[model samples]
Target: MDSSPHKLYHVHGFDSRQFLEHYFSDKSDMAFGDDVLKFPIEKLRQVFAVGHINGDILIDLSIGSLIHHLYSASEFFKNIIVLKANNRCIMELKRWVDERTGAFYWGHTSTLLQEKEENSDQCQDQEAKVRSAIQHVVKYDLEKENMTDPLVLPPADCVISVWLLEVISKDQDDYIRYLRKISRLLKPGGHLMMIGALDITYYLVGKDKFQGFTYDENFVRKVLAGEGFIIDYCNVKERTAVSDLTDYKATIFIAAHKEK
Candidate 1:
């Protein structure tokens, strides 16, 4: 395993299957599922269920091949555009999107969503709704001026990003630049819903260890305001599970909108 998970993910590349099974499997890592999955999933259901974030188009810039959170998004948005930094992750997403053989099972996530909505039988339909809502799965490079240059997408009405910017950014400056790129995708007054870990330095993906930019809740609000966003809602949940895969103190979710 490389010292930098980014090198493994963005440079050399690791098995997307391992990445998924390591975290999303029914018997996956406990710490990851609790703080990373369950906490964020709850926050998503809350924010999306409220009518504060209505939109026609939603863009997702998240890590790996996970679409679990999009289950809530599918209920509100008409079209969902997914942008990935690497082709491997992009292909992983497409495989699940197409329901191809060997795809990672998101049944655990579907079950969680079902439990939240109190509809035990809707697990099967959650996958179908996400598949239908995803209009495109496109590859992008954050280093580029236009991450999706030459394939200009329509500005989004809202952007949902989780567990991505922190992993890809090497420092505070990189975070700001990457945020700017993401903000560009939003139309003026569009929303940005972000989720990340507080004070997390690194996280394990299979055998690989990826470094993350550590920041507190204060910085999250500050950065969003600096980028011309108005804070609408914020939720911070303390860590409840124990795992050596990652060392995060808390999970934070912020819903903000770009100033018109």
Candidate 2:
């Protein structure tokens, strides 16, 4: 079976490498992480299975085409509350949405107005461009270091974070805190399906050393258990190829829900 996500007319060999490279760059360490590739299949299946997802809001951290796919597939697409936490990621993703006219909300770790005032004309235009692409988009400023404060986010039925937990917290406690905060963004009894890497590294804003977090399946399950999320389905696996042939193993995907 061909695993490439974007197959035209069911024809394979589309060479998605260029598309991935242009956006992901040599930072395959961060870009093509396990969640980036696997969640398309895993998340989609989970979302589809929950046939009642119509009218549910979805917040996506680190924007990608997954929302677009979900949008196209479900009657619930219009009800999704989309979000991209990172600026650079949102910028690139906004470009994609521009071409496709995806509807979403772009949440920023920083203020959008300040960025417009400080950045160059090209930069300002980019933000405007993203706004033009979507029928509805809202930008919110959140202090990246602190996720504890009550945030004014759109009410969501389900919150999905693909490849996001690794970037927010370094250790188990902080990771759990961040997840709890994000989950709070959703209404009670909502679901959450997240895909995180087993061992992954990345730099925090102003932090020099790119830190890595490693969590086995049990560890993650325990964390979620405390946060009112019960693991419904999980699959752990490894992948063998990035750009430079330097491979990595990931814990793969997990789909869970906030127990009613």
Best lDDT among the predictions, by candidate number: 1
C-alpha displacement of 234 in model 1, angstroms? Answer: 0.9
lDDT (10s digit) by residue, model 1, range 1-260: 65654553455555777887776678734446876667777888898878878788999998888898888888889999998878888899999999999888888888777778766675559889999999999888777788887799998999999888788778899889889999999999999999988888877877678777889999989999999999999988888767777787888999999999
lDDT of 2 at 177: 73
Candidate 2 structure quality by residue, lDDT tens digits, 1-260:
32222221101111222334432333425444333443344455455556855444566553232332232123343444455443444455555557555433322201232242334343334334333434433433334443322445666676667655664566788678778777777777776777766765432221122334556778888888988887877877665445322123654667777877
TM-scores, in order shown? 0.93, 0.62
User: Which regions in candidate 2 have their CA more than 4 angstroms from the true location?
Assistant: 1-35, 63-75, 100-151, 202-209, 242-248
Q: After superposition, how far is residue 260 of candidate 1 from its true place, in Å?
A: 0.2
**TM-score, candidate number 2:** 0.62
Point out where model 1 deviates above 4 Å. 1-12, 28-30, 118-124
Error of 2 at 169 (Å): 1.5
C-alpha lDDT score of every prediction, in listed order: 0.83, 0.49
